[model samples]
Target: MSNTPIIEAIKLSKQFTKDGDFVLNSLSLSIPKNKFTAIIGYSGTGKSVFLRQVLGLDRATSGIVRVLGKELHNMEPAELNAFRKNLGVVFQDSALFDDQTVLENVCFPLKEHKRSMSEDKRKAIGSEKLKLSGLNEEHFNKFPEALSGGMKRRVALARALVLEPKILIYDEPTTGLDPVLKQKVDELILTTHKRRSSSTLVVTHDLPSALHFADHIVMLNAGAVLFEGSVSEFLKSSDNLVATFREQGLNKYGKN
Candidate 1:
């Protein structure tokens, strides 16, 4: 893996209006290539806001976001599109097309991005990704509505990987699932990341999952980064806020 960060945020800040408080306050962080990092915080502490900035879906009020060496906010539209092809995102909601079958949903990206790919080739790639995500051929023709929550998550994962992106992102991936389903999804995430060797970033409120799976942790509080370090460091933190917050997470949701 490269020493350089695959994604870097430098002095980044975002505020909806001139007088509004910043959602992300001067945040500077780096996500190293081929590593798994987790961002954890309270619901309204700007975790999702920071994630949107990372994807260039939202522009920062100040500072820069660099993804794969390109400045996201400054990129030309065409350049950004090309750059985006290297990243894949799995949203909180599976975001599957209810009208489409699992196979079609997985093949959607290929159809949009690789227009020259033949129909057979697209289906072949989709099948391969779905299998990699722990789904078998039996589920291919099933619509998203016919699947369980865990199955839907697997389909979303398959779709996200269809493009073979180097950077994989998950936004509240385990949200709304029961404890059993949540564990299944968490294991799937770890397995998929290890198998693909992609740099992964997860923004989650589930602290136990983050502590169990992340190589590094980024904690946000009151619109600023309160801590950034290894899981061990976080657990042993001297900051009362960090320590207390961690205890709460462990107590409420023990590691899988």
Candidate 2:
């Protein structure tokens, strides 16, 4: 794998209003290619904002964001749309369509992007991805409403992987899950990363999960990067912000 970053933010900043505080205050970081990176931070600290910038859902107030070697802000609408196909995102709430069966939900992306693909091909790919995400054929016909929280998340992940994206992004993936479910999700993420060899980025407050799965860690504070390094380097850092965050994580998760 290339050592070059799959995503790069150079002095990136985002402000909602002219006088409003910047949500991303000149943040800079590089997410290594084909690695698992956990973006950690407290609420309202720009973790999601940074994700938006990366996805090109929100433009920066200043500076630049480059994903897959292309500057996001400079991409035209159609260009950006094409660029987005390289990314797969699992949302915090699973975001599954309640009206659709698990199989149909997973096939939606193929329908949208692979217009030339036959229905059988789409279904085959969808089924394969769903299985990869740990959902068996029995769950394929069920609606999202019929599934548990963990099952719903698995469906969402299956849909995300249906595109065979080079980069996979997860937003607060373990938000409401119990400890057992959270560990399952974490393991599922790692399994998928290893299987697909995709660069994975997770924005989460689940500190224990982050530390357990991420090869690289980035912590944001007040819209800026407080720390970015390997997991061990992060743990050993003498930085006050990092130390406090680590302590709080340990206390909350009851992990040493």
Candidate 2 local lDDT, 189-217, one digit each (tens) = 99999988889999999888899889999
Model 2: runs farther than 4 Å from truth? none
Top model number, TM-score? 2
Ten residues in sequence with the least summed lDDT for candidate 2? 1-10
**Model 1: CA > 4 A from native:** 254-256
Per-residue lDDT of model 1, residues 59-130, tens digit only: 999988888888888988877777787888899888999999999999998998999999999999999999
What would you estimate as the lDDT of candidate 1?
0.90
What's model 1's TM-score?
Answer: 0.95
Which lDDT value does model 2 have at 204?
92
**Looking at candidate 1, what is the lDDT of residue 124?**
99
